[model samples]
Target: MYWHIEDSRYRIANPIQYLISKLGLSMDSLSQFVLGAAVSTAFLGRKIGPRKAALVGGVLGTLPDLDVLIPFADPIDSFVYHRGWTHSVFVHALAAPILGEGLVRLFRGLRDHRWLTWMTVFLCLSTHAVIDAMTIYGTRIFWPFYPDPVGAGSVFIIDPLYTLPLLGVVIWALFRRNWTSRLQTSVVAVLLGSSAYLGASLAVQRHVEQMALEIFSDNGGKPERVLAIAAPFNILVWKVIGLDRDSYRNLYLSLAGGNEPLEVYTHPRNPELIACLEDTPAYQKLDWFSRGFNRAELVDGRVVVSDLRMGLTPGYAFRFVVAEADGQDIRSVTPKRDLSLRRADAEDFAWLGDRLLGIPAARAAEAGFQSTTRDRAAFDCSTD
Candidate 1:
């Protein structure tokens, strides 16, 4: 549900294309050359000179995101984990002095360019913060001093419309090194243009929020907080969470298609039959992987529990995998009737704490329910 929307500003995917479209290196290897050119440009007029400057720029530019490779991390978990600390101001402050000192020692003979080495580290690290601030995933630029996230709310996570031109210019600049000034100027201009576009997109998202609210109001409903998610590229899908004053209906709305009128769908959010999966051994075991998605409830003659987060798009019908009590241990039971049955209260669903974790059903492997042992035994004795 989270997008690192701000990482794109400083980290151009195709810098060569950016150079060429605006300046002149229109070749197949434009991407690599433009990246080299950007580094060299940053490190120019220093101890490292053009070649080393390019090397420093290229390395530091990509170094900000290296902490993403944490050990024992799951594939999806990596996306949720914050790649913030290493990319924050704290890391830059600590890293710069260490890097600068090391570089000075390595290139000690060039004492005249010592300041350039320090400047290279500072600028390279600073770029990470600057670019991160331009996206939706806010950066903690003033870390240690301030922990608040600074989100510019500019730029979608994946927008080819804004990138292609910037990349083209970078590629052109690499081919025609003489036009560095023009190419650099164009790069700044493109950055500014993209910022403006992102601001406009935020404005568009706000208008969408307002329209969604109005739709709810027109239908005689008032929403509390509305979250607008941009689908595909420009389409807005709004989920409105609200409690009706009289009937206390929980309503959710969607404006997915276009600007005509939002399609409305109402669900009981704070339903009277609220389910709570209490503290239990199995539930505790699944807790690490569940991530606040598990809920247990009793409906009809059985106990039904579900993982709300797993089957989000399919609706509640797909959310809960039903189970019932066989005896002392709750066992897996197919939902025999309609799925829409509601519990009278939160406590009505409280007794299903054990069943939600599937421990009872797992224990039922020896009982009348389906078991691997039964299948195995039948196969051994059968001649036919």
Candidate 2:
């Protein structure tokens, strides 16, 4: 998965609960994953000399994310930038031999053992690519070498279970210099075990969804679509989102501990808000890019377009949010969320649809403050 470094730095000095509630994972995981890969290189490549080891480590640490700069080349290729060329095993294979040969000449001292250096470089780069392939986000590993994205679809982007064990092994290895004995075995064990655990988690989540379907069916409503997400690691809190037959009958089930299947909290879907987009060309273009994960809602007169494929929440999470199709001075949208409303709150439009059944809000809690805050008047489109 592509961890935008800019996004990680923005959430520093927060509690784990705050991180989980807002950003969905601890910020420290980002540091550990990158640093651990570098440390792993240092552990394996010391005989090749420390400078070469550090070079291999640094290159391996950064090679997977080289695709982030792809946007600078062309604006139309933003999404294509992430999980792109660098993530491919074919690119790693081609780049590693070239990098290893370059390092041998540049370092001078490692000229005699050039093959070992090349092997170390190839292994380090290849491992980074393989680690990324374990996540749900697809990576075109083989590229022109294969053209198919190798996706495990097991772990989420911010999985502590996968990160922490590997981190723990790296930390242990950092303290103990010997790489061939205990540390190597421990690192391999943790890495492979984490992958197995995530696979099991995916299987368990699928079974839980089947159980949820039966419960929803028994409760006198059939869900047209369901999205089940295991909150954090242990499947303690599973968030269940369902779109009923009418589409407006949206339901949210926060089932804790996984065993007991809850019916659902009374929530309504507002897919009709997407209908309001029929008048806008920009929205139509965005919809094409979003690939059915797009959701549009009228908030404070201007429409709020959310690409659900990104973040489930706002604030600390990163998403591609844009203003409505109204031609006005609405400026730009950023990685930060508009805290005034949420995906759940936007579902209220369905209630607004039912004039007979409606209710409603305070700015204090909404604005991340204890007291009411003034709503900054954004571009108003109704009068326009």
Best by TM-score: 2
How high is each candidate's TM-score? Answer: 0.49, 0.62
In the range 166-221, model 1's lDDT, one tens digit per residue, is 45654554355243455557655665675566566667657666766677687656
Assess the local accuracy of residue 115 in candidate 2 as a C-alpha lDDT between 0 and 100: 80
Clashes of each: 25, 1
Provide the lDDT at 140 for model 2: 70
Question: How much is 247 displaced in model 1, in angstroms?
Answer: 14
- Global lDDT scores for all candidate models: 0.41, 0.48
In model 2, which range of ten residues has the least summed lDDT?
A: 356-365
Per-residue error at 373 for model 1, in Å? 38
**What are the runs in model 1 whose C-alpha is more than 4 Å off?**
1-58, 72-79, 100-154, 176-179, 234-258, 266-384
* Residue runs of model 2 more than 4 Å from their true location after superposition: 1-55, 70-81, 103-153, 219-224, 233-236, 243-269, 275-291, 309-384
What clash count does candidate 1 reach?
25
